[model samples]
Target chain A: MRDLVFRNLRGRPGKTGALVLLVTFLSLTLCGGGLVLSSLRAGLNSLENRLGADVIVMPSKAALKTDLDTLFLQGTIGPYYMNMSTVNKIGRTEGIGRMTTQVFLSSMRASCCSIPIQVIGFDPETDFTVQSWLAQSRQGTLKDGELLVGTKVNVNVGESIKLYNVSCPVAGRLAPTGTGLDTAVYCNLNTIRSLMAAAGALGGYSYINGDPAETISAVYIKAADGVNVDDIVNSINIHVRKVQAVRTRSMVTGVADSLGGVSRTVTVLMVVIWLLIWVILLVAFALLAGERKREFAALRVCGMSRARLSGLVFAEAFCVSAAGAVLGILLSLVLVRSFSSLIEGALGLPFLLPSSGTVAALATVSMLVCLLAGPIASAVSARKLSRVDTGLILREG
Target chain B: MDLKAQNISKRFYRKAGESNYFYAVRETDLELPSGALSVLMGRSGSGKTTLLSMLSGLLSPDTGTVTADGRDLYSMDDRKLSAFRAARISVMPQGRAVLDTLSAWENVFLNARIAGVRDESLVPRALELMERFGIPDLKEALPKELSGGELRRVMLCRSLLLSPEVLMCDEPTGDLDDQNTALVLDSLRDYAHQGHTVLLVTHEADAVSYADRLLQMDAGRISTPDPV
Candidate 1:
């Protein structure tokens, strides 16, 4: 039986080869699109998990942006800031459990640091955002001259980085967050204040320490358990002057809507390609049945039953489709792995490919769908071809 | 044992404005005895092939019954009939019985495989038949690569593989030359002499000379053999 199937496929290479290639293209589209969508979902989840703060309070004069990029964008937008006195006012709000202030400072490209990286300043005693995440890796607090680096920063722990004539030793590295924070550096308030004063003496003015009117970039607030988030957010907007409080839920939804649109488009395209492949297979098998009319008749006269003849046809289809499915899956694996970084750069979304178990499960499902399409298209033709009267065929031939 | 057809007839529907039914084979009674080669001769459209198809169970008669050894052949279900044919009967079709993709050897053993003979014991018998048919060296060649006579000889090997109890040949030498024709005729006669029934259908007059018993067909009816 196997010998017959192989010989038959080899006997008519043109039709068989065309069917195999069509199946391959269909499988590639399914597997590739599935992998990309899985990565996007995982990336989005990671970004949402990393935002531990419930509300972000920034100056009202700044542009209202809720995307993930805004959470860790390298440079401040036009240096909009409110006085540090607002921190006290926000901490006294009704549902606020913890409050902390973050100072934003940017390093120049040709400055003493030599690399333009985002510098974030956090108060060690009051920080509930960055300090909570760092506790998972290390238990100690940040000293005055120590810094924590993001995963993407090309610096090693214990190495000193020169920032605007002030140098600090790297304490530890943070895990990847799949956001702009993956490239930012973190330190206590004293370190950022000292760096700001040192750069000010060298003709560049960003911020000055010990000044009565010092301003901070944003305030991060964590709502207490059993507290209504909407109540706290509304209370802050009413009581805190010249500041706007934004909920993290609103930021995540802004990004989710865009991703949903992309996912829908991919699903529609996959369905269209599948329908095209099915139609082509039906036409090809119908022509093949017509061409092999006498051959089927001969088999019938040789004592081959109708059911056996149809089984042979289905077996042939299975062989070709299995080959094509395997090839398509292998090609998709190479393509997705090779261009993952570029895909992330192009979409401007944090992306992490799904785990190995998920990938294997998806590949198996796609290959099975592709492989079954061939047998389904040929079933009707098989029955029609087998039921033909051998007596008439012999006379006609 | 004997294979007999009793009061058998067949008719086809005519085109519009024509007669309602045209009889291809009129009601006829015939008996083909076991252990001898019986030759049925006729011209084209004389219903020789149609009658042969009825005898081989390829087609059912519109009227009456066909029986082998007192059991009705057409009374059995399709599954049992197919298995009976594969095990006890062999049919050699005209106009390229060999498949285009397989070599002569594969074509010969394919019958043995269909017969459910799983081992290589039939290999020697297949090769021996090919040698006797005078195409021993063409066993490895495809059907397309063989000449007309060589292909006919290969078909002969395929039919003889199962050593069937009843053998039916439909214009077996239709495309062969005189020499290959003599070879096929001699093999069929020898096979029948071995206590198996052989029925040969053809239009050529030369084939009548090799018949152990001759029956003539004209306009869907059979008559006694003409005097030599």
Candidate 2:
């Protein structure tokens, strides 16, 4: 049966090629679109998981919370800083749990990659946000003068990154967060202070105060259990002197809504293309029935049962669709993996390719859909041709 | 096995109107006993092929039964009837009645393959038949690469590959030259002489000398009777 199917496909190259191409198109759209959408969803989930802080308190001049790290990717975004007095004042407020501050500093030059890597300085002892995320890529803590690089950082573990004439050895690499954070570097507060002092000696006072230890950029706060985070944000906005408190949910929700809109548009487009292919396949098979009527009649005369003949047609379709599906999924995998960075940049949102297991599951579904599409379209033609009068068709021909 | 058609007739509904009907084969009784070659002769539109279709169980007669060895062919289910046809009957269709994709050898064994007969056992028989039909060297030739006469001979070899008890040929010599036509008729005669029931439909005069019984049709009925 397998030999028969391949032989028949080889017999009519033009028709078989057209059908296979159509199926490949369907599978590519279904699988490729599905993977991109799933990756976008994964990006959002990763952001929500990593941004564990319910509320972020930053200087009022900071218009966007995520822009704090965006400067690492894009140079022109201005950095804002508030005095440490604001952090202390916000910590003393009610309903605050496990608060930590991250200082933002930038270096004018770095030999790591094209863009100047953003240097984020965090208090190792009181840090609650990044340590948990770092646990996935490496163990232990970030020691002084050692750097924890993001996944996007060209430097690898145990490698040295020259920043501000300070050659910092990379202690570990962080797992991909699929955000602007992936492009940044993290280190202890003492190392950042030295980096700041080094920049200061060079006449690069990119921070608010000349003293790095006295100024902090943002403070991440977690609301205590049974306490509303919104209330904390509202209180910080009103009670704080010059810092604006932003809820992480607001940032995440905006991203989630955009991802949903993009998902819907992609899904609708994929559905339209699939539907068009389905209709074309139906018409193709129906016309094939007409063209191959005499051949089927000949089979009937050869003592082939109606059921057997129909099964033969369906089996041929199944083979072509299977070939098309496997090829399409492979192409999808290549295209999605290769252009992931561009996909992320174009969307201006996080985009992460799904894991191998997740991709396999999606490919299986797409292949199954393509597999069924072929036979279902051909089954109609099969039945129509199988019922044809063998004697009449063969006799006339 | 003896082939019998009892009061068999076929009618086709024309698209001119729902109530209109055209009789392709009228009520008729016929017997094609074992060990004889029967030739059915008719002009175009004479319902010769339609009657052969009913007799071979390819077309269901409107009223009557075609029985082989007292077993009604129409009464059998699709699977059983197909098996019966594969085991007991083989039909040589008109025109280029070969699957274009398969080679000449594959076409020859197509019937045996469809009947689920293993190819290894039929290799000797296929080789012998192809050698007899002078298509042994054309085993690898596709249908398009073969001439019409060679293609017809290949189809004949295909129909004979399974060594069925009943062989039906519809215009087997339609596209053959005189030499090939005479060769085919002689083979059909030889096949019938081997105690196999053979029914052939053709307009060629050379077939008359080879027929053990002659049947004639006109306007969907056995209008003329002749003795061969």
lDDT of 1 by residue, A1-397 (tens): 7788899899878878988887788788888889888877876786677667888888877664642356543222335667777778887898888788887776777658757777788898988778766776667988887889887788998898888878889999987665677778888888887777767766565434444236687888889998999998899889889888888778767667767877788789878987887788888888888888877776777777777789889998888788878888888888887887677677766666778898998899988987788888889899898776666667665
**Which residue runs does candidate 2 get wrong by more than 4 Å?**
A65-77, A109-115, A206-208, B13-21, B119-121
Question: What does DockQ come to for candidate 2?
Answer: 0.75
Candidate 2 per-residue lDDT over residues B1-228, each given as its tens digit = 899998988888777469888898888888997899999998998898888888998988889999999999999998899889988899887777789999999999888888888857689888988888777899999999999889988999989988889999989998788887888899999999999999999999889889999988888888655466
Task: Residues B114-217, candidate 1: write the lDDT tens digits.
Answer: 65677677888888998898888987898889887788788888889888888989998888888878888988988999999899998767888788889888
Candidate 2 local lDDT, residue A35: 95
Instruction: Show where candidate 1 strays beyond 4 Å.
Output: A66-88, A99-218, A339-350, B9-23, B60-63, B219-228
lDDT of each: 0.79, 0.85
Q: Docking category for candidate 1?
A: medium
The TM-score of the first chain in every model comes to: 0.78, 0.93
Worst 10-residue lDDT window for candidate 2 chain A reads A68-77
Global local distance difference test of model 1: 0.79
Of the candidates shown, which would achieve the greatest lDDT relative to the real structure? Answer: 2
lDDT of 2 by residue, A160-235 (tens): 8777778899999888877778878889999988887777776666454657898788899999999998889889
TM-score of chain A of 2: 0.93
